[model samples]
Target chain A: MALRDEVQVGSKDPSGFGVHRKRFVYFALIGLFVVQSGLTYTTSTEVPDSAATLSEQARHGEALYREFNCTACHQFYGLGGYMGPDLTNVISAEGKGPAYAKVFILYGTGRMPAMGVSEEQADALVAFLGAVSATGTYPVRNMDLTVWGTYREMHTDEK
Target chain B: MKSEWTAAKGFVVAGLIALLSGALFGVIGSWQHVIPGVVDAIPFVKSRPLHVSLVIAWIFLTAVGGVYHYLPKIVGAPLHSTRLAWLHLAIFIGTGIAVVVSYFMGRFGGREYWEFPPVLGIPIVASWLLLIYNFFRTANKHKGPWPAYLWMWGTGIVFFLITYTEANLYLFPHFTGNMVRELTVQWKAYGALTGSWNLLVYGTAMVVMERSTGNTAIARSKTAFLLFGLGFTNLLFGWAHHIYPVPSALWIRVLAYGVSMTEWIILARMIRQWRGTLEEGKRGQGSMTGRFLFASEAWVFINLGLALLISIPAINLFTHGTHITVAHAMGSTIGINTTILFASVFFISSAPITKNLRVGFWLFNGSLLVFWLCLVGAGMVKGYYTVLSDLPFQSIMLRARPFIVGFAVSGVGLFIGLWMLTWAGVRTLLRTPGDPAELDIHSAFLVEGPGSPAPENGHAVRQGSTTTLQP
Candidate 1:
């Protein structure tokens, strides 16, 4: 239970990860993790619109999304299955909007199976997609790459 | 007969069942992808989560069970508490049932990969806490400086609690409010969560090697410790590679790429070690555990290379969200993790490796090889067109259907192989502990355990069932 006992109990033997060094490495890594997690939870979150939060309708839509397990096939930020296109910016993409997304939700495409959503449910899903698109882009085709293999726009506040 | 070893065997049996059923669901899910509207009763949506959760259960159950069985021997002490261990198992299985029922009833509200009701997480988390307490208390009794595996297990036990809880952060309004934050945090949790389990699994692998070969120095070696340190570092930082395409901060993505490159070191070490294992491996034919361990080494070589390439941003731009990711995931979970677990399972049983077991081994690996390649081929095609061209998803998927069908057909072989293995694992675990074949493991006594030769360890000396020899 004691930190000393936990870190240095068996460490009575010398050489190779012992005493002071082991304790130092362990605590330092834990400290770094804490710092990284904090920074990630707070300052690191960058989105196009600071004001674009999920609405009540979108929240219900998110629940519906989970209930139907759309993530099993579709993607958000290209982080889901390969069966469907990335829905991150689908609502705002040219030639695709609320109606287009709604149709697909209501009656599935040839490859994409229908989720059996009603019209009201379709409207909510479109709202969820709209809010998601407002947050940021995916398949970000622009290539202002840094020499160190990072996208240039990720660090900027620019839209 | 207060045989605590029975509790450990129980976990192994449960794990094997989970694995067999999970692989069955996986086979169904694969076929469903190729031909839609099949298995309408348990659709792809339901089957996918069932497969994922059950396979995950298999990993956790067997790995934790290994710890329970082996720790007392390593420490030369009685386990801190058998009651708590049983309690942990009870809660876990109960939660698992609830999860299954919820998914069947279409009552899910959790994130991807963990789509069960959020409330079920409470018992799961509670059980993990019992494991953490029980692990530290027993492991703290270890004599001398702890081995690399011990450090690995301890870190894994603690972090599973941390990251599993972190996974639930979406319950808060803040995390769920914005898409960018939700995606970033979700993946961050998932990445480290995987690392947590990897520690448990890799630790068990080291223990199995040490016990099988009677090489105590393996776990205590500088090389082993160095590898653990590298793995730990990567678990902490390498996770961001998953989100390179997402609009997270540049540092997050760049750090992931840097950390992921560390696997090159791991690969080089494993290859060097494999040369040494080559002759020993030829003699390992009748040894089911030995065969599985060797297979895992080969898998690690394959997967680690695939993982490293995809971690690169240049290539990741093409591969990030494709079947390539699925391939990597499958390669790790099946090729590496599952093989390691099979080795552990067969090791615990000390079961005589049979002709049938050998058949299953080849069948599983052979099918998995085809399964892995099909995913890679499909990924390569889809990633190319999806990124370089503006082809719709339907068109691209059509191009990839041949591979999906290949993947589905191979999955049947994979399932048959798993069924054969599960039969062997369960049969051996259910055998009378005092059977002649069982005593060879402890009689070898390179390390402390069930039939530990040391008379000072009162519990194992009395418990003759754990004396099963390492075949």
Candidate 2:
């Protein structure tokens, strides 16, 4: 078990990842995996009402988003291309409401290429953003971090 | 080795085709970013999936071929069922074709990277199960404790099934309810899924290293296991770094940050490892496989630095949505994974070094270096501006456009290099087995070390012959 012994060149490793220890490691990995899976499903994730159900128009916008490959440029919840701002709370963010989002969608901002959607389509895209915003607050800035790294705003329903 | 062509080499052939075709699509996709509507027939929307899926196919096909090829050799036995092996290939290829056609026809529902329809996932899942059954049945026959590579392969196989299934959790009503949860789960699954395949690809790298050098001890070394354990831990916990901006519980991001920082330990150990592998160290400069392995080492360092910095919460807030993330992804996939896989390909085929491969190697590496730097530069500019200036997306993109253009131009060179390399690899694979120039696995491996082929034309020759390994 000595660190020096474990690293010897071409050294015969009996307990160094030996088959005898395979079962133990395998179980440990699976156990860790199960707990993580549970945490991902139960503890860390939640849903608000507006997020739990999207309007019919928002579904259309979702489809259009995928069809346009908008994700290649924009992100939701900070998990996309940096080419554009995070759209997670764009519609609800102060000074930037649905009208502001609609104009950019309808007429291509020199920055974001015009998505070439009709006015109605732009409305739907904004609606989609509205639903996403309803999901939670992002860039979770002003919260004190607990020692365990849990956040204060697990509810994600802040408007 | 007479019967080897039927089961294993078929996958190699399919994989090479995938690599060549994928590289072509990747070139097209990159161009679209610079010149919008450049390729009308296949827009970026379609090309992205074609490139992503096909390149992914190359990795799986080749990596799976490696496992199939090496399992019997290492276990000192014939395959458990060659019929099942062939069936596995048959289904895989069959499904692969369907996936490609779906992309061409513009039928897509699945998320990014895996943009094919959700139903197509059934065959993929089913076929992988066959691999699991086949892999365990064959690999279990090894006489002693399984080497580090076996553990890697086994873990990769099992985890692919687990994480892949996890990726589809979006289909369930529970996960889809909240965009936050949905996005978090999506990336969590994908992050780990990426890790699963890395295990597969990295396992292939280690196999090529062990077999070529005839250094079984390296794969069985304690250090190798410790490294594998470390990587596994990261795969489990470090994934959440990908979704740092999501409003998920802070614990996920914190845990990932802590785990990801452990790459430093991996890096330090790797430096020590280079010193320990005396045979590889001495002969590596001369061998094609050795050169590729070394290239991967350099890439690991470069990308790990970027990945670690971005894992930091403050840095990530700016870099997460930018070209920097793309740079990291590209560095890992193309720089590290592709190079290692190519090493495995050339090593397995025992292809003699040739002019085409030499040109291909230099061009590939050279173009990639330019491409990688441009992306990082673009990412830095975009990240800084997007997070700071009230500049519209256009102004920021305009600033980044020069880098994007360079990236696209370099992509063409990269594709050309891949074309030449794929031709070399496939031609060598298709050559019938009885050539005197080529050494049979038994005879060729009897000499210690893959001493690098002097030419890329005929057979892989051993340079510094040391100990003999029993076939």
Candidate 3:
């Protein structure tokens, strides 16, 4: 059987129309991707020192988080489910602290099912949340929007 | 049937089984939301991964199976090592079983999406190596300038290994120490991982189109290569869109947002060619491959529209953690990928039209449309309540409950439709395949060569004479 088509139909030029121009466009797009990836590695910040230091209890709580699939409902920093509020700073928020979190974890709340977590698990979860709370806040409630669709964390004296 | 191709058929059958099982678990998981303890035997945590991993396995297994089946024909050579292909299949199936067992035992040590025990990653990676080696070895034999599909397959195969390895980077203390870096890396790997499989699946779509239409020029066309390049660029840098809310680098979000919008070019191109495609769809309606190809086109339009909208930061703020995200996922995986795979499956099997199949197809698509809309509705409600109101989580869920119930109920219809189709597919796979030469020519009415008249008889010509069918 013949490999190439018999009639040699369509455009004959190997690179299609404007071959050299297409090559330039392809390279340009690739260059943009490389630069963007580099920026992610360089500009992104890491976890703070306090939050990075995970206590044994927090470690267990972290495991428990995955084991229970808390992400199925709860989120940290607005990245998990909409079924629960962002818990990034739940432990540190005014009028809500470790005790508030522990009670919810140990027993079922209105919408959130009681994970049936034991008292020990609840303490560890609180410790985990306490550590996470030290990292950052969620919803970035104070948004000073820039033209670029990014926000600058507006200064507030409320804290 | 070629003995060498038997394992490829087996892989596809395994994928269908996985699809059915995963979807069953999905139904259970969704209903758990409607009635809190519906499946007390398998809690949401366990059910979620079972659904996620198995469906994911379906995509990989089927996509890879399509490659194995088609590679030899396209490359004009038998696979370099059939033994390695078999080993790859064996290892993947064994690993899949292991993953299910771990999920059953409630042994989850990894992150979301891949909630299996971390150790399972090792075997999974090893099996992938066999595939990578086998694919490259086989594909290298093609004796011409490579087409866009080959490039897509090569990139997808190599990158999946890279991304899969990167996904496990959390084992390193340096990565594990910083939560921000950890999450960024995780999403990065996941984004690339998804892109990799998409490349494989899209390449399969191209090949199936090329073969069905007998239009080799389409694969080699300038437009095809440009689309492949655009998709590759997005696969590389567009992943950060998923992590925009993670408080990562501002540049990551900015770059991803820009990268993602480029797909509008593809959508626009599709729009330009819509009339031609509709004409082609009508011509090919008799062929199962034709119907599926048309279905996949519709899905691409719908899913791409949703994806483009959500990639915008302002909209993502509402949709990010909601069922809208799930909608996007389901749209891509089920709506687009699954349809394309089905086309490939029926093409390989030469599945004929039956009343049952026609009914299944309509039912599957109809149920999916409702299922998809319900998810979007749920997400919109949840997003509004969570972001704007001070409503509690349960209250928001209560508002979304009707849509969630609708989604779950439609899911049953989808499963039943899938079951009938899968049963037909499995029967096709188990039966011996006929000579490709005879089978390929008979389907010529489904597509035409570039500028060539539809042959009165089914056979197409090459070198100005009737020739053996290659695809």
Residue lDDT tens for model 3, A1-56: 22232223333344354545655765786577556545554455544556555677
For model 2, residues B134-245, the per-residue Cα lDDT tens digits are 8999887676677778888999998999899988887776666556677778888898888888999888887776656554555665666777887888888789888876
Most TM-score-accurate candidate? 1
Q: Candidate 1: misplaced stretches above 4 Å?
A: A1-15, A49-52, A109-116, A143-159, B272-274, B434-471
What's the C-alpha lDDT at position B409 in model 3?
Answer: 95
Number of clashes recorded per candidate: 7, 11, 0
What docking grade applies to model 2? Answer: acceptable
What does the lDDT come to for candidate 2?
A: 0.73
Considering lDDT, which of the candidate structures 2 and 3 is the better prediction for this target? 3
Candidate 3 collision pairs: none
Give lDDT for model 3: 0.77
True contacts kept of each: 0.39, 0.23, 0.26
Evaluated on chain A only, model 3 obtains a TM-score of 0.70
Docking tier of model 1: it is acceptable
Give the DockQ of candidate 2: 0.23
Backbone clash pairs for candidate 1 read B438-B468, B439-B467, B439-B468, B440-B469, B441-B468, B441-B469, B441-B470
Q: Tell me how each candidate scores on DockQ against the true complex.
A: 0.34, 0.23, 0.32
